[model samples]
Target chain A: MDVLRPSPSGVVAAEITIAEPMVRLRGVSKVYRSLRRNGTDVEALRPLDLNIARGEFVTIVGPSGCGKSTLLSLIAGLSPYTTGEIDIGGRPVAGPYTDLGIVFQKDLLLSWRTILDNVLIQAEVRGLDRRKAAARAAELLALVGLSGFEQFLPHELSGGMRQRVAICRALLHNPPLLLMDEPFAALDAITRDQLTLDFQRFWQRDRRTVVFITHNLVEAVFLGDRVIVMTPRPGGIAEILDIDLARPRNLAVRDTPDFARYTRRIHDLFIETGIIKAE
Target chain B: MSTRTRNHADAGHPGAIEGKPAGGLDKGEAPPMRRTRRRGAGRGFRRFYSVIATIVVLLIWEGGVRLFAVPALILPAPSVVFATLWERRDLYIAFSVPTTIEIVIGFFVAAVAGILLGILVSFSSFARSTFYPMLISSQLIPKVAIAPVFVIWFGTGLESKVFIAFLIAFFPIMISTMVGLQAIETDMVKLFKSMGASSTTTFIKLRLPAALPNIFAGMKIGMTLAVVGAIVAEFVAADRGLGYYLLYANGQLDSPGVFGAIMLLTVIGVILYYLVEWSQHLFMPSALIRAADLTQATM
Candidate 1:
């Protein structure tokens, strides 16, 4: 079991003030046995321990088979951890919670619905008032800067715009915690970087906790309040770097020395294993 | 589910990259010196030309037939057919009313039955296992071969024709709808999972709404097939209706009337087809807003 030995047990010695700590995982691991290709059992995740605070932005970065997504499934309670426990808000997570909302790599907007209708889906799913949710749907469209596109169908918007609608959907129910899995990884580079700031700007407004998963180091560092770096498969935490940079971060920061230095330091940590060497 | 996302991939129009900045360029491209409706207008023009060409073809057909003095036996010109239809108004009206009644009632029944069965198969994997094979086998057995039996079973009445129409129209809707319901983005389902949506919520919002576009497609196809099926069944046995009228005209050596019968059916088919399209436009998302962008994805 790889319980991330706190980077500085002494520095964080005082009781963690963030009420509820949101989510806590202990000794969580996942094993997937393939039935089609010779029935080989693959241990997708190694035992692990981690916690996300009530209103912190954390990003998990790794390659395709590194169990990053498996870990996410465990946290989201979509998939069971083979041998461990996950707790959310001090209660052992038996299954998924209504208090959490998620977004994915594909926007997955319903074709039959307008942008307004898609956003209302979250509240409708939770059995909240549909009329009320319908209004909140409009509010969220504006929140994501998609006010006029309330009637736009999923097929009618650009890739970036569709994703913005997705973000509105995730935030519509106002879940205290948001879990995102490579939501921007599918978009073009420019769109991706811009969306990173756009999402962070929204996160800053409400101060809700966010647990995001991404493989792009620049995106990881750009969005996270605390960047949690994981090693290759059977993965465990390798670095927990707290980003202390001042906020209201925009595209202009991408070229700054501090951004470069922080990026390089994290790059060195990953490449130390020789996978991503000096180049 | 494989079905959910797969449906999205297979859908006639995927919902990304709608209208552009007037020209045919992708939105991501840099703003040009001038907004040219070159691509957009070009497509519109193509559609315009097609309508014009169709009208021109019809006009020439009518003119050539009229000027050549072709006998009504060889070819009843469009005007003669129109005149005949108007003169025999009561005969056409009586026939059309019953035919339309059978079509409407039969269509509603088939749609409801097919959708319910499809949902049942989708929700229960066990039922799918047990029934899908039989379902497929039933589709393969030609309804024409079984029309006599249906006549015996339900009589040479409206019920028999309705039954045949339902049979012919059920499969496409079933398959499309099943595929649509299953066609869901896993991430979206998982999102519901994260938000604590139960299986029902996943089905209602993520699956049902996602499936609607394809469902509409299936319905359109099913509705069209209903008309053809009803006509076929009527051919097998019936006293009234256009199908029977066609047979009567042939027996009586009324060649113009026979051809008129065929023309009447063609018109019915075209009208039914357009009705489905128009309804889709009203109930489904506004195709106009998306058409400005989707109009370009011609392969």
Candidate 2:
């Protein structure tokens, strides 16, 4: 937390330090230009200044069209920003980098390859040794409770299972930073809960820097070390709340009084920003 | 989570974690063998019906000819056609050799050229814009009208027949492969690029496999058309093919000879088409086939 000291206005305080953050953004903004309509630039995200520490799990929650995904796109180098700079491990992110892994909302599994091969895609792309990578892929898949389903096609697995396979694929190469955009948004309530718990267990096993985006307040608080609350359109960070819940969190943690207070605080912040009308 | 009860969670099945034995390996899960076995049995049953349907159609055709009292000179009965085939099997086989040779050579040449052209056009926007219109316009011209031109240029040998077959077979494969390349999900492409995959690896591992079903689809159409092209070229000018034999028999008013030649040509076409189809199963993953079938069913 020393690397990220917040000012009174809820923005990261400007300070120079010898120790660099895992991720740092300064005056970053994105304006999507519409080719069909001339002279129309849709400002997706306003200038965003933030810093994330290594091994920290930060969950961002925002309303629809509030540019939560745009932030991920900028960091993943899938799209470019209109202004400012983004750095990962002290290197400017000029383009897609090999040191990061991303999980989209859909599983995006290639139906043609077996689940094992799909997980090994990271190694194939990075030109790593196949035998060693294959061994790691098997271990990761087993860690995710997909031990016997290595040869199964994506179509043969259930939706939750497919998403788990996607997770395994994302983590196969053991990237330092993991970017997820509503990865569990498409699942049912039960599956979502199951995955959330399983993900907590997995994340605690070997801490990797994680930035997760979701719309669920409870999910944001339960999984995040700090939940970033974002305002409505032309999205910008409203506040960052540190979750005080104990580690090795499970479904029972959701019922705790501290978890309820964290979710209530985030809910109130959303209401204040008019992201959701207060009932 | 024994393999016996895994079907309940197979693909889009509701409640993926409802009934599971606790302490099952890692989590409650089973291998994919059981689902594959059941699907294999279903496919076998479907093939059985396809064979039965072909036999029933032949039976009906044989019965109809006898019941109508057709004259042998005008309309040869199926039995007479079979007898003619048996009696002069050597002549038919001799004719088949040349036709088979022409088809194999032409089909492969067309396949290689079509695939190369397809890759060139789809990968580069410049090539696509420049050549795509010409590709379409070329297909619009009637292939039959150009068969004579090939004979005049390449001469009335195996060369002309093979060239004609290549001409007929190339378009469908090119067009279908192009469509397949375009049909790949944009997200899938982005995923590969995001992983820092080189262009060559993406094309070979991602784009190629994703496009297999469509490529094979085009190959099936091209195979049938290749048969047509070789026969048409032989009909124009040739002495060793079944097409030539059919024309010669027609001139002599030997109806049974004509029917036998026609049957032989059909068998060749079916065999070629099946060969292409069998490769589809080999090259295409079963998931893609299932998705295609499900899409057809829903549509």
How high a TM-score does candidate 1 get? 0.83
Tens digits of per-residue lDDT, candidate 2, A195-265, equal 89999888877667899999998999999988999998799999988776767788898888898898888
Candidate 1 scores a C-alpha RMSD against the true structure in Å of 6.7
Give fnat, all candidates: 0.43, 0.43
Expressed as tens digits, the lDDT of each residue in A9-88 for candidate 1 is 22241234244567899888888878787777888887888888766678887767788888877887788778989998
In model 1, which runs have C-alpha deviations exceeding 4 angstroms? A1-20, A36-38, A129-143, A148-156, A248-258, A277-279, B1-55, B63-71, B288-299
Candidate 2 docking quality: incorrect, acceptable, medium or high: acceptable
Summarize candidate 1's per-residue lDDT along B1-299 as a digit string, tens digits: 21212112112232322332233332462222222333545765786886799679768878989899888878777777778888887998789777777776777777787777888899999989999889999999999889989999999888999888888888888898889888776776777777667887677667775676667678788888888888888899999998889889888878778777777877786787667656655544444324533543552
| Model 1 chain A: lowest-lDDT 10 consecutive positions | A1-10
Q: What DockQ does each prediction reach against the true complex?
A: 0.29, 0.37
Q: What is the interface RMSD of candidate 2, in Å?
A: 6.0
Estimate, for each residue in B1-299, the C-alpha lDDT of model 2 and write its tens digit: 00111222244333333343334333333323333444655776887897899788877877887888878998887789999999999999999999988987888888888878998999989988998888889889897888888899999899999998999999999988888878877667767877898889888778887777778778888898898888888998997899889899999999999999999999998998888877665665544566765675786
